[model samples]
Target: MEVYSYRSDQLAASPKEVFQIVNDDEQLKKIFTILKDIEYSTKGKRSKGAKFRITLGVRNKTYRFRNEITEYVENEKIVMKTKLKQGVITTLFSVEPKGAGSELSVQSSIESSMGVRMFIMTVKPVVKSVMNKEMKKFEAAVISEN
Candidate 1:
């Protein structure tokens, strides 16, 4: 498994508010420019078992993947899973209150079959770097909204 983690802080928002923004499709689209579209399978907003199709831009290439929300804890955590061409990907978002704002942490893991391990290893650093940059953008977006 290849693991990558990123963390960011946004001012003047609670953990709940941060979580709401992260889970909101409209808000996320505004924050993540790489997301061209998000299609939700289950209605009524984000929750465990809900599936979403996300179009993302990676290294000048656009990739689409179907992801399922596997775990959720209101105001605290969310976990999602997806199968990509390279492997099984799992992402966890954790939020915690910080003084008058919030701290958000994202942890992503990519597990590949033996045959594809080398591919995953080769891309892990690039993926981590991109995720860190995106997380900073997310923090700025949240702060601006507040």
Candidate 2:
């Protein structure tokens, strides 16, 4: 298993506010730069059993992955899992109220076969670096909105 994690510096919004913005597809699209495209299989609100396909462009290569919401807790936690050619990716998002603002953190876990271990390990730092930048971008967007 390979893990990558990041915590936001601090946002001028509540935990619920941050969670809502991150969960909103439109808001996320405005904040995240690496997402090339996203399509939802359903037209319902954000909840468990929702299915979506995300197209990510990284290092000049495009990868499409299907994501299903495995677990969700409003203003608290979200867990999503995806099975890709390289591995099984599981991502967790947690939000907590802090000082007059809020803090949001994301943890990603990748599980792959034996041979891909080295490749995955080498890519971990890159993933963390991107997440760190994205986290800052997200926080800034959320803070500026208020």
Best by TM-score: 2
**How far off is residue 12 in model 2, in Å?**
2.5
What C-alpha lDDT do the candidate models reach, one value each? 0.80, 0.81
* Alpha-carbon RMSD to native, per candidate: 2.0, 1.7
Query: Best by lDDT, which number?
Result: 2
- Per-candidate TM-scores read 0.87, 0.89
After superposition, candidate 1 runs with Cα above 4 Å error: 9-12
Clashes of each: 0, 0
Residues 23-67, candidate 2: write the lDDT tens digits. 787788778887878898977446888788999878788889999
